[model samples]
Target: MRLLVTGGSGYLGAAILKRAPATCELAATYLAHSIAQGNAAAFRVDVRDADAVNHLFDEFRPAVVMHAAAQMTGDQMLAVNGDGSRNIARAATRVGARLIHLSSDVIFDGEHAPYDESAPPNPISPYGESKARAERVVLDELPRAVIVRTSLIYGFDPLDPRTRQTLNGEMPRLFTDEYRCPIFVDDLADALLELAQHEFVGVLNLAGAQRLSRYEFGIKMANAFHAAPRFTGALSASYPGRRPRDCTLDISLAQKTLRTRLRGVDEVLQDLPGF
Candidate 1:
């Protein structure tokens, strides 16, 4: 299999690249930083630039494309996450490649809990709106694409950004009411790779088994890291803007669909040396 991974240097993308099959030929694209770990041929191409994305796709001509590139914040969120996904979908279709697009649980408004694959998107935040728009554009471009909606991705190898922030006292407080099913990066990566080798199409809810509040998750991570000055708990309403209260994904379909076991944060954090 010839696989192309966008955002190859990112946390999730790099995990996928590192865990890909040995027989598979790999290529990756990045906007700024090049992939430092994977053995794939790297190309620096921003996904927002349709021509650049098309040229890279035409050259690589991958059998499968994992569109993980996205912008979470700033004025370029729509351009990078929404329109950029469109570019990837178009390029994948042109190359006759199967596209697996990474989506977020934030797409939902959070009024409902335990969302399934059939749930419709009603984004509440800018990031959620961008990801939701990305999903729509990707599906419009390639109807056969797999839209894998996931939750907060956490890991301990290099430590996730959220955990890092908590450990270093970067964040003043963690929301006690905001709940999410934080998936282990390895589990998610493995699941994505397994999906890549299959013909599955349409949306799938892939997330951790346990649903936890941000405060609960943060506390566990901080405990594992043996950090001092714990993060104070606060309600979502305490913050300035509108935030999703609960975006827990129902991964029953994924549980039955793939062999990869999606472990919860508690199970994953047990891997720490003295946790």
Candidate 2:
């Protein structure tokens, strides 16, 4: 399979590149950060530019496109995350490539926990709103696209941003009430590739099997990094703006469908060689 992975240098994409099957021919695209793909070729393509994306499609002619490039926060959220997604979807359709877009659980408000694919999107944060728009854009452009809604991704090797932040003692207080199903990067990567080779489309929740609060997730990180639990104090998120409380996903469909198992934080942490 000729495949293209956007955001090649990013956390999740890097993991995918590392774990992708040997049978598949992979090319990864990056914006800024330089990636060292052992076998896969690395290309520079900005998803925000429609012409650039089209050029990439013409050049690479990828059979499967993993739309993982995203603008996580700030004012550029709509432009890079929303419009950028539209560009990718259109380009992917032009090339007749199966698009697998990565989406977040924050699309739904925390009032509802264990969200299924049928849940309506009611995003509170700017990032979440942008992702919700991205999803719509992808589906509208490519009806056969697979939208994988996942949660906080962690890798025990201290590469993932969230894992790095916690291990380095960057977070002052971890929210005790905020709940999410944190999946290991490797597990998520494997599941994504398995989904890519299939004809399955529409939204699918691909997250960790176990759901826990942000505080508990930090405790797992602490266990892996050998950090003090006291460093990650319990602090309920409080703000004037609406904050998602429990963006936990229901991965029952993925569990029943895919052969690749989505392992939880606890299981992953216990198996971490560095821990």
What TM-score does prediction 1 earn? 0.97
lDDT of 1 at 222: 74
Candidate 1 local Cα displacement, residue 161, angstroms: 1.4
The parts of candidate 2 lying over 4 Å away from their true place are: none
Q: Rate the local accuracy (lDDT) of all candidates.
A: 0.91, 0.87
Model 1: per-residue Cα lDDT over 1-275, one tens digit each: 99999999888888888889898899987777779765899999989999999999889999999999998889999999999999999999998999999999999999998799998899999999999999999999999999999999988776778778888888889999999999999899999999999878999988999999999988878777767645799999999999989999999999999999999887877754666
- lDDT (10s digit) by residue, model 2, range 161-227: 8767776778767888889999888999999999988878889999998899888888877766566
What ranges in model 1 sit over 4 Å off? 271-274
- As a whole number from 0 to 100, the lDDT of residue 62 in candidate 2 is 96
Instruction: Name the weakest run of 10 consecutive residues (lDDT summed) in model 2.
Output: 230-239
